[model samples]
Target chain A: MPIPSEHQRPTRVTAKESAFTQLQQWIIDGTLQPGEKLNDIELAEALGVSRTPIRESLQLLEVQGFVKMYPGKATQVTEVDKESINDLLPPLAAMQALSTELAAPNLDENVIIELEETNNRFAKAVQKEDYFTALKIDEDFHQIIVDQAANKYIHSIVASLQTHVRRLFFHNSIILTEKSIDEHKDIIRLLTEGNGEKAASIMRENWLRAIDEFHSKKTD
Target chain B: MPIPSEHQRPTRVTAKESAFTQLQQWIIDGTLQPGEKLNDIELAEALGVSRTPIRESLQLLEVQGFVKMYPGKATQVTEVDKESINDLLPPLAAMQALSTELAAPNLDENVIIELEETNNRFAKAVQKEDYFTALKIDEDFHQIIVDQAANKYIHSIVASLQTHVRRLFFHNSIILTEKSIDEHKDIIRLLTEGNGEKAASIMRENWLRAIDEFHSKKTD
Candidate 1:
């Protein structure tokens, strides 16, 4: 029963929401490791909420694939399925590619600047070999495009799949290389030139590359 | 508080799952109309379950965007946003296109026959002006491709989006015409030829045509 250190409850959201968000983050960040049993009573104490919200939060988490609940038994975080990357990345790649295609023709100069800034940070982190920061910044780079695409359904689906991808990366060694930095630049240039088809193809391959990297890592 | 008459307690599932599935169907089919208030106790009695499962079902439905819950007030079915069709269809179109591309190269003879047979039924339904059966058969047609693609994440996201599309169609005048029948035939023909690129393009356009049809309905 590991409790988050920054356990102060946020204001405005219902107790259940606060609990659910914190619990999900902890699970994703590996603060609450895989197969770790959760006790609603203990978590209720840790989060400064009553047991009701804790119970409610578990129900939500279970539905979202973050946790598994057994009847009259323990609730545990789901283990990272490394193999899921194979099944996961293609559809995510498809959606990200579509997002790039949509955003290409519509990117405002300011958003393009933001993407440039995020990529700069990503390159710097990768240069320093801080893969954690680089991965987060990589998400920041993609988030800019997904936000620009402005389709709620695509936005939500990307967010969920990205979380699963992040969880897997957190549990294993991420193999992002200098090659990705160049692809980001190409994606930006294509968007600037409004060459959506090429940009989208590049973006889809950019994500599918992860499956390849994971396979290489497993073989290593 | 519509207690679905068909709600004889189902066997095998956890009560919460049974409640969630039935409630979601009721909402989608308009049995539980938009903005209608839900009372958990009443739902429990109707579904022959306890209030806990009914409450759990509401939480899940709210997360899935079928309902909105207000603190200390009411949990009501979310109203259909007619404008959402504009935002919703494009990503769904993208995913379906990708599914078609993936399923194309690998579709065996028997699978091709199943697709052709499904298209024949779709055409016959249209000839009889049976829009209901036609729409359902239309789902069966696309679903085969999605299943054949064999991506779990894509499969789940497509299922969720298709439900929303179906809900919107259920409430509005679905003007699916003979043009879609021909498109389905072309899709089958192209897929049989293993021309994935052309087949995917046609599949994308086939779904996007709904947005155009929806727009025409609005102006009419």
Candidate 2:
């Protein structure tokens, strides 16, 4: 077969990346349970790809601490060990705290109003038992802080740390809607008043509180 | 042909992981410059692997923020702008500062001595112009602090951040030998005195100072 010309366009989505996305979603959505062994043949067949892509997907998962690979044994979705799970808290707290700090000086009157509107929407979403919408609104509020910070690398790294925390949020039994919204309102109030230190401290506390709730469930 | 058993041992290393390792090394070593395109077909042929593994490796690299992929454009090593890099520092500093604080209280006397000895070795290596060995010693000293922190998740995340920072250090012309030894001694002194706060603060300053040096070089 002749090589594709340099000007010829490849498909937008590559097979290997597709497998990676699907596998990641499966893990996140709990379709793949923790410690479930991933048979390469079965995964490839399920993913409608060759074993090469399936193997590659597994390696990516392994690096994210989502999957464990044994030399002679099968690759399995990793169980969240207590220590590993709790260790996520400090960095999450730090990142949120930093985001708030960076965002405080940058927020103008219009942005503060926008943040309050988002907070109000989050409250309504929680009241209506719309966890999905609430999650999005919640994420958006935090995203604004990082976006305003104008740090692409920092924002990206924080985004990765947030992914790890999202799994715990799914498992959390606590309805943080009311408390979180209230705290978020306070964050907005502080930012509006130009109280950066208090805003950052409160944001850090918000993350720590969520972590505490998750740990309580983990222990029980 | 008889199929291999599912339980068949995977004694040999997989080709995919090898390719991934090589790619990661290139990015870390600055051999693959930021914004440099990584053509899958070209990389695969050069590395003696099929495109499958190379594409998978790129996916992982994308998640790590080492590479960026646009649907129509080429996949290239990412060049994070300065603003985003600054946004990343606070949390990293917070994480390492927390590590130092936690480590100070829990560090065993012998481990503290071992770290000091590693610092001395670093000084010796620097004196002999063995930059590689000096670098390893520097890594070991910081690692000892992380090991004492007793938080694996924090260490893992910080380790990822270190990968990017190491590149900055590579370009930094500062010998860092005399000043690093002095800073290490100060840190050790504070730890021995059971001054966790002071030790953590000093460590934070050391990192901040390094970042200042990094920024200066970038501008120069």
Candidate 3:
């Protein structure tokens, strides 16, 4: 008998993992509001799957702090707290800076062109006041460097934190400032010049700036 | 009818979580070797519980990357790859350094005295060549700062990565050097002096030194 390949295996586990990812995305994009009830049955119906996968996904989400389970009661999307934002942003910034630093030496002309195109799209989205589109493009721009860094741990850490950050973006209709675009351009130039440290520093500062703006807007 | 208190409720979930933590510790301490098969029945017997909690724990352990599960087959502990160590260490160091930085201003004289006591125990454990005891004490010393930092995100991130670091300690019989102790003293001094940045920098350097030593040993 021959061994079965991975794809030949049952889809139950895959469905559960994908459901988890989908629900997480929903939470991040504000499709599922914070503190809103999450009924496994309703989610199953919406996703066109059985309740089992939704239940499994909810368990994982609870473990990841995206949801809260009340054991025999109800599961609800967790509220994105301001203190959590303050606690998480610095580490997120550090990880992004480290990613850029590691990615600097690996950048080639083709990759640089790809990044430039993404940045152009980001800028255009911002100019058009398409906050969601700009947010997606901004993620794509940073993701390129994060992928290039090739550090699974950093990647996983950032991916986990980014969900909360995205929630912040959703809750606050943050306008993309020209300063952000210029910072991106500066980062690109630094990378091109092979100045990893300066690029990393600027990337960190960029994140800090955004965080400061969020706090300022919140107070206002 | 009156509502039952949390303690009066069923203990199934708590048991499962505790079992997971126990198994993880076993893996980190090398009591469960990498690639060792995890038999639910055996684990249940050893843990003095039914196989249900063990089975649930195994599922979570699989999700956590501590164990690999094959559907309808076997579950096994994961190997500690050098590449994973390299990828994880920097982030771990950054979080620990951040913890120290945040905790510095809040470090009261009592907390400082407690830390000193822990470090003295750690040094004695090293002098006595009790690697396991030293490891435990070292964890205690750093954990104080992490707990004091009061940032659940950083605390959680460091806790997750520290499991892998402990596994590395188990796999390699790394002797605690005099330099390591001196570095701890320097961090304490900086913290006492209210120099958060310097303390954080030293803490980072201390962790980086361990990673460097591990790499050199691997090459040898």
Candidate 4:
């Protein structure tokens, strides 16, 4: 059999992937509020795409626990419950720690410099109280490490769980910002020193700190 | 506005859910081998269902990383890659550890006795070289704690990851079974003594051991 040409291979982003990304953003940013009905027709019109892609996106979101789709009923954004945050944290922390461990052995000086630059940007964003910007920069910093790790499963799980974490950070940004900057510095220092185990442990502790901060806020 | 009646709530298991479960079992058990094409018409006929549910089931399985569907082409079972296992183990172990930690405070004498009984059955299954039975019992042993923890997010993640882990165990049964039984006994003893931290730590080590065993086998 002849090898399939490059164009014959499936493209990474289709109409459905685009739709999923846009809708996921809306959900994460609270533009699509929790408990609000997702009207496929209206969404398709708004997004300038067909309803099929919108419907497919909704299905994907449902699987990610971002939406609730009732058969023969409307789909709605799922509430960001404290219980969900609690449940998501441990796995998220574990994967982050694993990613660090895997990435450490492969970290080049260039990558470490890139991470430091990203951390600088993240610190600036946090200083400016730009929680959203800080969140994205923070993700970029971690994404580089996870990508270096070359573990697709951990990458995917972390990507999904980060949406919920982003929402939590939006509220607790002020309190988490300074500490988070320090934590990132600590992690970068450990990575620079080639201390993978200590870096992984610190990464886990960083996530646990977020969880603790969330609980304190919730109780308040 | 009037509230929807009890009958209006969507039932948990629709035809799609049923098809997903059955097809998943076939995939997990190796009856439907990796790279095998999933013909919707044939599967629908075999399962005594229609093509629509089969198609939907395939989609769900694709999302869960069990199968890969190409548009206007064949849907094939996904091969369980070592990288995938490596990515999945840390998160699975973390959630299992967290489950044990959460359930420790709630473990009654009756629950401890049930766990002991399950461990006994698990040991017997291993001794008899019944890996499938041992797998199921091992799942049951950990599941009780996860259920008791009442964290739906962890529960769902664990349940999905377990499908992949189950497949791995099926191949490495003899090697894993003996070590797994001892680990379960260790976990049970810790739980009996209400040493949640130690139990969680050991649980994490138990999973890491499996990953190590998988790697050693792969290298050989």
Clashes of each: 0, 2, 0, 0
Candidate 4 chain A, which ten residues in sequence have the lowest lDDT sum?
A168-177
Clashing pairs in 4: none
DockQ of each: 0.51, 0.39, 0.45, 0.45
How well is each residue in B1-220 modelled by candidate 4, as lDDT tens digits?
Answer: 6866766655566777788889998988778988899898999999899987787678778888889988766789988665566777877887888888888888889988898899899899889987678878888998988887787767777888888887656544425548888888898899889999999999989877877777777642
Better of 2 and 4 by DockQ: 4
* Chain A TM-score compared with the true chain A, each model in order: 0.89, 0.83, 0.86, 0.86
Clashes of 4: 0
- Candidates 1 and 2, the one with greater DockQ: 1
What C-alpha lDDT values do all the predictions have?
A: 0.88, 0.77, 0.83, 0.81
The parts of candidate 2 lying over 4 Å away from their true place are A1-11, A15-18, A47-53, A82-84, A127-133, A172-174, A215-220, B1-13, B71-73, B80-88, B125-133, B172-177, B217-220
Q: Which candidate is the best by lDDT?
A: 1
TM-score of chain A of 2: 0.83
lDDT of 1 at B122: 92
Candidates 1 and 4 compared by lDDT, better number: 1
Candidate 3 residues lying further than 4 Å off, grouped into runs, are A1-13, A37-51, A70-74, B1-13, B36-55, B69-75, B218-220
Q: Give the residue spans of candidate 1 off by over 4 A.
A: A1-11, A31-51, A69-76, B1-11, B37-50, B72-74
lDDT of residue B165 for candidate 1: 89
Pairs of colliding residues, candidate 1: none
Show pairs that collide, candidate 3: none
Write model 3 residue lDDT over A51-123, tens digit each, in one string: 8778778877876788998876778999977656678788888889989988999999998998899999999
Model 4, position B80: C-alpha lDDT score? 61
CAPRI quality band, candidate 1: medium
